[model samples]
Target: MRVLVVEDELPLAKLIRQGLIADGLLCDVAIKGEDALWMADATPYDVVCLDVNLPGIDGFETCRRLRASGVATPILMLTARDAVEDRISGLDTGADDYLVKPFDFGELLARLRALTRRPAAAGGTEIVVGDLVLDPVTHRVTRGGTAIELSVKEVQILEVFMRRRGEVLSRLQILEGAWDNGYENRSNVVDVYIRLLREKIDRPFGVTTLKTVRGAGYRLDEA
Candidate 1:
């Protein structure tokens, strides 16, 4: 997924960007709040890693303006401020989640996964269609009483399909939401991965939940 990292500190910003890229995310960096505002307004990012204590407009005002402009992309705020009021202000200004630094890369990755995998705030952690069950936290797949193993990318793609259940997802949408942005490979990778996923998660179990829509995209549904 495409992520915007808004941090003024050069070293820290690079670290966050590198970590996210390794996790298969497309990322952009902004060192100032104004830059953040324009970047956010210009691109359709899935998540924003916003720094709360920015030098210019600050995260609070930046977040407020983004929301005011009707941009609802998820925001994960990074802050050194530990006060309850600070977190409250972040949330009140439209940040979806907050992490207090210095934070673990694993935690940040997990939070990003949580934000983008979701179709809505009220969506459940487990996605089910037919006998297939996927646990987002554990990255485990199960059908009936048996476990199915998938590569991380496979799991991510399947999650997007399972969450929507029956909707056809275009290739570009799958790549945008399930894979890292700015990946250099060029091929029918999505179809290849989906076929591979079905070999493990569907065929062996005598289930066929993931289906391709002729001339359209792919869909996953109990029906």
Candidate 2:
């Protein structure tokens, strides 16, 4: 997914961005709190990897402002401050999750998945629309009783559509949710992937669930 990394340390920020990119996420870096606030306001990000100890405003204030500004995107605080008070402060300042420094990348990824995962419409892990079912945790999709194998990005994009259901999600929104911060692709990658997804998920069935919104974006309908 697309993420914004807010850290004062240039090396750390670069490292995090590169790592996230390797994981199929688009990432943007912000070395200052003001820039973080502005970037967050201008762009839609699925998650923001924030560091607590920063110059000027600090991560806490930036997070607090983001929440105050009604940016509901998930925030994961990564910092060197591992004390009880530090974590409490981070949570209190509007971080959805917190991770201390010297953490496993695997754990961080797991946490990020938890943040992006959408709850079932009926309120569970298994999201169902008609005979189709998707398990966010397992990244599995099934139709009736037959399993459909999908690539990682395909699953992620499908999850975004399934989560919103009837709403028309623009290309920009889809890109933000399915990529990382500084995604600079000017190609029709979204359309290409959507076509690929349609071939795998829609063509086999007589039911038409995915629809383009005519210059707007795409929507998912349960049949």
Candidate 3:
């Protein structure tokens, strides 16, 4: 799953991004609410981890504007205060859940999972394409009942393809979906990763579900 973490505390934001990445989730950091708004508009994030204290707009106003613009992405507001009023205000402003500061990492991860499972979320907890299966929450991938070992990036790329199976995706499209703005777009990283993915998900099983479209890009289909 892809996530947008909006927090003015640069150190804390990096820590959160690291934790999310370690759990096989693609994450992007936005230090300001204004930046968060545009990033959310440009990217299809599965969830947003919004901090109540920000440099501009704060979390409440940010959440309100997101809803006003019709961005229904699940939001988990983070705050240093545990006041009931803050919680209520966050919920009233369109936050699906709230996490208090100095929180346990495990709980944060669990809350994110719960938010994404809600009815309003775009995709389900698990995705299946033919014999291939992926559990976004558990970060597990299996083909024909056999477990497939994949790096964090491989999993992210595979998730993107499986989520949009049968659609032709160019290198730029895949890069944008699986990576954050931190990555240099000029590199041939997408092709390298796609080759690595095929080695495990296809060659070993004698299946060619991932196809290369000449003059186009790539497509993931049932073998």
Q: Per-prediction TM-score, please?
A: 0.73, 0.77, 0.93
Cα lDDT of candidate 2 equals 0.84
RMSD (Cα, Å) for all candidates, in order, is: 4.0, 3.3, 1.9
Q: Write the per-residue lDDT of candidate 3 for residues 28-145, one digit (tens) a residue.
A: 9999999999999988889999999998699999999999999999999999989999999999999999999999999999999888888635756778999999886667899999
Per-residue lDDT of candidate 2, residues 1-223 (tens digit):
6688899889887887778776766688999888999899888777888988889999999999999999888999999888999899999999999999988888988888777764233476787877778886677898776889898889888888887898999898888777655566666988988998898788887777889999899998987
**Candidate that would win on TM-score:** 3
Note the residue pairs that clash in candidate 1: 24-180, 26-181, 165-220
Error of 1 at 66 (Å): 2.6
Model 1, global lDDT: 0.84
Model 1: runs farther than 4 Å from truth?
1-4, 20-47, 53-56, 70-74, 80-92, 96-101, 104-124
lDDT of each: 0.84, 0.84, 0.92
Q: Which stretches of candidate 3 lie over 4 Å from their true place?
A: 120-124
How do the residues 44-123 of candidate 1 rate in per-residue lDDT, one tens digit apiece? 88899999989979999999999999988999999999899999999999999999999999999989888877765577
TM-score-wise, the better of 1 and 3 is: 3
| lDDT score of residue 115 within candidate 2 | 79
Note the residue pairs that clash in candidate 3.
none
Best by lDDT: 3
